[model samples]
Target: MVTGKMFDMTTPAALLADDTAYAEAVETAVKAAAAYYATGESALDDEAYDRLARAITAYEAEHPERVLPGSPSGKVAGGAAQGDVPHTVAMLSLDNVFSPEEFTTWAASVERRIGRPVAGWSVEPKLDGLAVAARYVDGRLARLITRGDGRAGEDVSHAIGTIVGLPEKLGEPATLEVRGEVLMTTDQFERANTVRTAHGGAPFVNPRNGAAGSLRAKDRPYTVEMTFFCYGALPLPDTAAELADALGESTHSEVLDRVAGLGVHTAADTAVPPRTASGAAEVLERVAEIAGLRAELPFGIDGVVIKADSAADQRDAGSGTRAPRWAIAFKLPAVEKVTTLVSVEWNVGRTGIIAPRAVLEPVRIDGSTVTYATLHNPADITGRDLRIGDHVMVYKAGDVIPRVEAPVAHLRTGAEQPIVFPEVCPQCGSEIDTSEQRWRCVRGRDCRVVASISYAVGRDQLDIEGLGTTRVVQLVDAGLAGDVADLFTLTREQLLSLDRMGETSTDNLLAAIDAAKRQPLARVLAALGVRGTGRSMSRRIARHFATMDRLRAADAAAIEQVEGIGTGKAPVIVEELAELAPLIDKLTVAGVNMTEPGATPPPAEGEEPAPSDAGGPLAGQTVVVTGAMTGSLEKLSRNQVNELVERAGGKSSSSVSKRTALVVAGEKAGSKRAKAEELGIPLMTPAEFAALVADFLDEE
Candidate 1:
């Protein structure tokens, strides 16, 4: 057992100073852990909870008679008592071992209990997701229940049908209760958050939290995609070996195969090579291999579960009051750490949403020095009770963006000040709108012109070459361009007046603006910066309506016919299109293309159709272009390079992965060049890229 400072005790030496105080602290810790485990979101991290649990265990060991009845040490971690339905069998939490030595010690204890050396062990990644028990009766999914309090769980049968990787009907008729994790992939999490942000809701902190919250969302429709991975089964097998036998399989690995055959998803790739080892060193090596691959895994994994592979050994080893004695979860070191909250910075996004970011006293976590973390919104900041100068717990959610979990209240001083959300926009002094969870500038287009224009000139939109953020800001500040359409009307003299606008630079800018007028209708629609309309949506809408006139004439019902344009978003699209009519008219008057090129009506009978650029020189290749280029490509922006790649019938990727067949590296080329060299991918200079495009055009 471990000893630490008591909850109310100021010093470690004073932990056992008062018996009553220690007892109260233990009780409080137990309650907090229970609540957190039940809800899947916690004020304290796993490490903190472990410390508190260890403290209570140490107290109980010294004074066994005074052990609290509801202590976390004596029972499985608590879960939601109420759910959609009750679990058929109790879903108990596993005992966690932090170190390989601790794991070895546990394995020895299991061997001692069984009165024999263990044959082998089965190891698998411990996914960080919501625990759910899915029951199948007569080859059909009957019910789904959340792991609530190791006893009764919530019924989520309604969401069972929507769950990916979970078959509604099994391959064969059988009454089996499959226990697994319900989780959202990284891409799914991002998409869900994007949609949620557009719909005026706060994005979930992490995928695990997102999955748990989305699964239990009562008010909203169940549109969020979630995946399930089966890890266990009922009739309550004593061990993985017994589970295999129960399923009429040979090895623990085979049990997973059988589960997959039943149309239930399992992490078989990671769970392979069930090795038999007489010594702890061999088992430790296997565990280490699994831990090393955690970063590359699609889903989040906090640890690895090592289970005794023999059914007899597990049976003889028996079970603890809470967890199985034959199995132990070797928890990975936490990616979170305590850091001082220096201050909070609010940033205005393209949509006018004011997002709060936490500036932290630099701390290293998961191989990266994290100096900043997202506070999400004002409500999240206040709810977490975060304040400047407070020591706070920070972690990288999904191993990507850093997030402030909560403030360390015990480490706080009176100097800590509350973060006040601003009443007005920092950029334009516009009144802030707090109607939604995320506060936004009320003066939408008038004040947020910089963001709108920047997005409009983005790679996926108009593919404007020289209209970068700095130029856009200068243009907006000088009142030369109020909207995206205004860019086309600027004269060479107006551009030359801006700072650093030389003769060649002015000419290049003019040429780029002139070229943007010929962009396809889909790109033009995307460039318009319509609410909830992205590249794909714009393409779909343009394809359906064919021309800008038809799209402008489209009502909500007609817009709703387009795929992904639901009832909620259709009206917004129609309203935004109507609002953008003036801008459209301005662009039309300036000779911007209203119809998609090459989409003209077919030629008359006896007349051959014009040749298409579908089979261009660079066709069927994946190219990744990086760094600033020289020569003809010098004036071409990153978006322009990508546009060139697309026009040549090749896909332009942002990263140089194994799928990248060619990499166009320019001056001051960085990591991408190094990676390409290492991978032996074909490399090209800016001049070479220009030549390649010229060749493609010559072929056309």
Candidate 2:
């Protein structure tokens, strides 16, 4: 930990920057943080972090290129990370409140300012993601900006190019401004975790971290590389219900709808401020009740924000020079528990990676049990220096994955044993390679575990139906099958013998497995669990070599020749094929259809289709036009292009997907157009896409 001498509140300390001023700075920061998190405020989110962060920044600015070792600015909000944006709106953090007394005190503070109990306010969920702004002019999206330092930010304007849901334009008329949060979906986070593990990057603590990291990643090519969502808008409408009612059911929803619409994501139910803090507290309780549901929501939120509804009253109320006076946020406490790490267990994965999981004495957190949090892999144990019998502090970090925050080394017994990792694959007995994040068994195709089984039964693999997770677990637990070869060898009678296995279900499963045998060699290769090969990669290999034996006969040189299969991946391919070859021959001899039928098919006789299966100007084109798009020429208006193209049987692509055709250039198209060019995709002026979609443009 970076530590510095405690600053003296008033005078000089040679060891410190300025002892007296530094102490005052520290006090101010702590006070600001205390104000932020104690209650979740609709006024501003992440208040505690914001308050201290601002204090640190002020001191840093005074002494350029200098930061206090222990200053809050040096760390992320939760004291977990240390990466900073160059100079976004100094991201002033919010203060929090937990108890009704604290909430009441904050409310009284607001009341004191307003000189009366303020009436009519809006309370919104404090979505735990990067906050951004959408500026629309003449009913069209002009620019999408991030809340960098609350004032200035890097022109991530390119996000408009790829982030879904945020439209290139607004749904209503006249210039409109909207502010919302960008968040990640659970599926996306899980996928990122898998990828990050593979990439040797730090695991993102939560969706908020995921969003913040991705959005600020200068190297990231697209915003969707981190999923984004827009919730809550400014420019309050006449009535609370009217504005809330219009969000989903109006043109405004449509204009900014592309971000969420493309993904089919839903927003949290918004509500106006309850008549009283008790009522507001009750709504917050519901938010807390589903805290475990952080995984289910398409977006992430930390707590509920309650705001006074009356815009006029809100103006009359004013703010604290730091946060809005009309709003207070009620946040659920972080799910932290003091649990004994009774023991540690090492489990091997499909690839023979040994992952250590902690077996904790049971406790409740976020409404779930307190046992068995993943240690990630053998390496994590050493990095964290965790051992069995440590009285550890475990918290459901970010309300998703449970992790050991820290160990109470003070409680460690002198007799604790250091954890050890296995040197061989438990399933196949292959030698393991101890690495930083994983213990890999180099046996390649031979090891049998979760990743392998999932790959084998994947949609592009054996295509087995009725052989879902339950059946797989049953088969594995029964000890009758140790490998994929055993799966094809199972008889209906053997399957029927398992508990809960009905005759009809057994018959259907057998049929499904039988049907899967006829699938092509690419799928066979995919099912064999090649480390770096996926369905898409497998397809590239198949396109290069049709039959399994044919591909197997080829060496590493030939495998590397495939479009997607790089030389680095070739050895894994060859190793996998070598291990699975005998099994394939056995299955083939077992009457499984191992190859595609018939003689080599004739080549296509016509010109190849456009890169996109459908070819029109817009077919292989992407356009993001901001500002007023005037006149018809197959030209999509900023207001209507999103729906028009999609409705016209064309898909509007996000900033980063392979499906993006061309990003249409427009005035201040922001980050989307630049990102399109960076991605090496074509860029087109409105006229270019216009001439293509003549039918729609000619309507006028």
Candidate 3:
């Protein structure tokens, strides 16, 4: 229902008279985006280019005959997610402009065609955040994908359910992927650093990086401090304002006002009049002014986004290699300065991959001091031809870890030499190995590190109150304890004999060790010197067997049979479990609690069991766990039941299914329970359905 005076692109036939020509235009746009991304120069700013891309897609959607080869509309990039979700589109990146001068040139070009200067413009601050595609189905969020390598990104829909600022369902029933940026709140970024400081881990460098990295960690736990907003909708919305109105869930800047109503954030600053008006110069002026004020914004801003407010004009402008002619992002200049590369050092990771690091003359950048930065790997040294004494340029990607962006090679003298990776592990003196992706230490199995007592005392584990990494290392080197088990063997006399262990501290340390003995098998599994088996996976492995004895006895096939375990991992798991059997038995005799009891079975059938204060809610409710239960991922069956009880307000019964309240949970689910849970709720346990139920129940 939207149109413009000068351009007519409402219908597919109107946009391109020839079907072949339309297909070529689509191909041209996809290729242009790929080529521009390949080169340093971008074809269009992200928003503009995306609009054009959407228009091309709209054309194709209207006329199947216009569908072309390599049409972005035909194929969607698959998102790689640890959970069950999949992405319908591969979100692509926009070529960015870095200065106000670039913005002026772009606006002028538009004006030359429009035959008039732009009218009054509106301006909004540019926000620095992660680019993503959030897909919705039936008005509910379906999937979220990152812009990976331009083809496919890792799927992160599960994280979406937990991400606080996004809505699980929109105002209307619509199936589309709303693309935008996800960001860390200002307060979160500041508080994150404080917590990071409390631990030995370095604080997150910036909000954007924190948001991006959190979505991809796949294993590390993340928080709900992230937020998202949509500026544009795709496949093209029924109308632009309608979509913008959906974004109005957040704000009311005319353009953003509509977008906010659509439940998206509007970063529209200075909405200049149509591309045909005289206000064009004003648009350029305001964008330039923002370049100066951007750094002062409460959150992060990478660039200003300028887009055509009219949906029809956007279709007319269409798309080129990587962007649309209707919109452009003017990026702020890089915060670059000179600093000395004090020294080069090589560090070995747990994997035994040796990489070079640059120690620098401490300098501040974007607000923080720059003392050191990662060089990525030794190949970077030889490729960049870096020298230790030469000055280097360091860059932080949206405030994340600062990396040696590139060397100021011109400052280097003839003294530069190629850096080398260490041939062996420094700690264990084992040979090094290499992968297609990374260099690895060939020390213990999976290059396993001897569990540093530091981990043993971590909050989730032993939690020895006062012990820290520095002290743990000291204790280990002094031979006070050899492994997690040896901690208990220490007495007051033994501890006081060490560097700083006082009489009172010794008692506390002993208490912690005693407490760790009672930790469950899953924690012990995580604590043991195993490769790739973290706490989450450990719980998963524990659920496969009734007791530590059973697990230690399991073969790879038995282990792999457990959901989530794949063939590639079978051997590694089998070998480790067998190797650790002796140690597990020793600890068992040492009075360590191994496996925790499985979920209390649902109350027996027809038995008048006492009404306990805290009986299992899901008890006696027949349930089936399926693809990616957000809860209890490790305990496949118990997890499914947990979902039924905790998420769906249903229960679990061991023997009854047809009579059960719900048999909910996803793929790989047997037909027996599906038929039962399917009765009224038809409880299909797909991770998605469970999530949908969860969203609804949460409202109560």
Candidate 4:
């Protein structure tokens, strides 16, 4: 359903010409739909399933005679499921549009069909859950039914007490049918898995699947609660004919309001609520707003549902077999997908930490093709029972790296192979240090000389202008440099002898290396690639200790005195610093600055240091910078902004939390910005952030 073009895709037309390929695609789609609708478990993820369905539809349009009877198009639950219980009215799925252009075209068609422009539009999230109808008799809940095959549904009245937000008895005694979605909240999903596993049940694959299983499940040892969000309501039975007629005539938003009054929870209860928009542009704006909030929502929403608010207009537009002409779902990108774990590659980092990365069969997720996902470590793979050829659920949120959530154990075909842990260092073929969960090369940084040296000269570290990975590799291979310290000792003639090294280039490289020697202790420390220290942590340490001599002299307890360094991490930092003592001595001899500028040392010995100034603008505050810097802050990287935040007397955090004082949101800010807005955290633009830290910027 994603509007963005998928990667590694075979043309739909190409597949249509081959009967074997067409049948295979159809069979795959049909099976996936059957499993998805019946048990809420499917081998194919939403994205893959939707792609197949779309292709089948396109093929059917071109070659009607070749259309298969089991095709998933224009059918509720892909016609894979059915129930005998008849519905008072059909429970239908909405048609989808992937972009504003498609949505505008759909709106135009609807207006043209109705012989007038729509009065208004109501927009709300299209909850990614199973649709169901709850019928209440005299305001007392009587039956719960799944939207099986649209015309009829299965009786799931047994799940009556397990659903939240759907009152057993209405505020007023009135017979009505509330149409809505049944889904588990994010917290509920996690708790459900914990409880299920505790009771010897296999954990549910995802929130949507868990909700579906929970809804129809009977005779289980434990109950996992699901929430019901009312999307529509209609009158049912003979006792509420008048109310039914009124509901039939009422606008969609008005219907939601009426249902809320009857003790049914609706989107109106949350930060993101349904709203009425006057035109297509407003509707699109609301759609974008909902999409922006998707990552922060407590539950999943695959798209935004936009419908004509006028009941009269709805009647004029009429309906199709699958969806109403008056409504359309604006689909967003798929955040999760099921893919095969083809292999696992262990790569050595600059610190010699060997990390396992899962090589997956290319799958499109969140508008990008992902073939590799972070695997944490061999222990994580073993703990999750991940195996080669396993069907793994891949999760990607915003710009965060894709990661394997877990393997879909139930979908395995027994061709899976156990993921073997490396016995030796994969990169340098040396003995591996397996004492820690993350295996490392016994040779440490020496095993990755080029990477270590490249990181040292990076822009956020020593900031040597002419040095890059290619140049670092060249120097390492040519025997001119073996480590970061060697960069400062390089002769001008040696640099000039390298390929493409002109006289101007050689001088620029030399000058850059010379300039790098004067960088503050914080930058120098960051360049050293300490196991637990990045730019921010290095800055904090330098600011706390003021000089390398003081930092090297501090023990774990003394290091813990600095903010954000925990007791457990303090000892690791101490050990890493001890190991790097030789390298530190080498850099010191090379004349790199040994103290951070503008920093005052801690009070001598055991005396308590003077308290920080409470009047400083960002004092005692935690700030997070996200997206891209702009205006005067454009030239600064995220690390530089963090440095500026610290210099301005604030603690910089990468994650947004309840304790976060503010968020500096910039261009294209995604989840963090949404989270800040959701949590009511104050937000400052890059310009505002620049203004707030003007003094620190001037110092830089």
Best by TM-score: 4
Q: What's each prediction's TM-score?
A: 0.57, 0.43, 0.42, 0.77
Give the poorly placed runs of model 2, Cα more than 4 Å off.
1-301, 304-325, 333-338, 391-401, 405-417, 423-437, 440-483, 486-510, 519-526, 532-578, 585-700
lDDT of each: 0.73, 0.55, 0.54, 0.86
Query: Residue by residue across 513-583, what tens digits does model 2's lDDT show?
Result: 88877776656766776667765565446545656666778889777877667787788778767767777
Please rank every candidate by lDDT, starting with the best.
Answer: 4, 1, 2, 3
Q: Which runs of model 3 end up more than 4 angstroms from their true locations?
A: 1-38, 41-304, 311-344, 349-416, 428-451, 470-474, 499-502, 544-546, 555-585, 599-700
Per-residue C-alpha lDDT of model 3 across residues 1-700, encoded as one tens digit per residue: 1112111112122355566666666665665555332221123333334445666766777877746656755332211112233334334444444444455677677656555544333344456676677777767786787665445566776687656446888777755566777777667666654554455343443455456656655564434367675555564243245554554332223444443455655443212211212255555555544543433345666566776555544544555544556667654534433577778876665434566779888865554677988877765554455666766656543335777644554346777555545667655677766653356566533343334445655765545566677666666777775555666666778778878778888788778778777665666776673555665566556545636766666677777766567987777778766756665666777788876444222233486754433334343444544333444233334523343343233333332233556554444443333234324444644554435455433422
Worst 10 residues of 4 by lDDT: 2-11
2 against 4, candidate with superior lDDT: 4
Better of 1 and 4 by TM-score: 4
Writing each residue's lDDT as its tens digit, candidate 1 over 638-687 gives: 75577677667677776666779899999866556755764679999988
**How far is 489's C-alpha from truth in model 2 (Å)?**
6.0
Task: Kindly give the stretch of ten consecutive residues in candidate 1 with the minimal lDDT sum.
Answer: 2-11
**Of the pair 1 and 3, which is ahead by lDDT?**
1
- All-Cα superposition RMSD per candidate: 9.8, 17.6, 19.8, 5.4
Higher-TM-score candidate of 1 and 2: 1
| TM-score of candidate 4 against the unseen true structure | 0.77
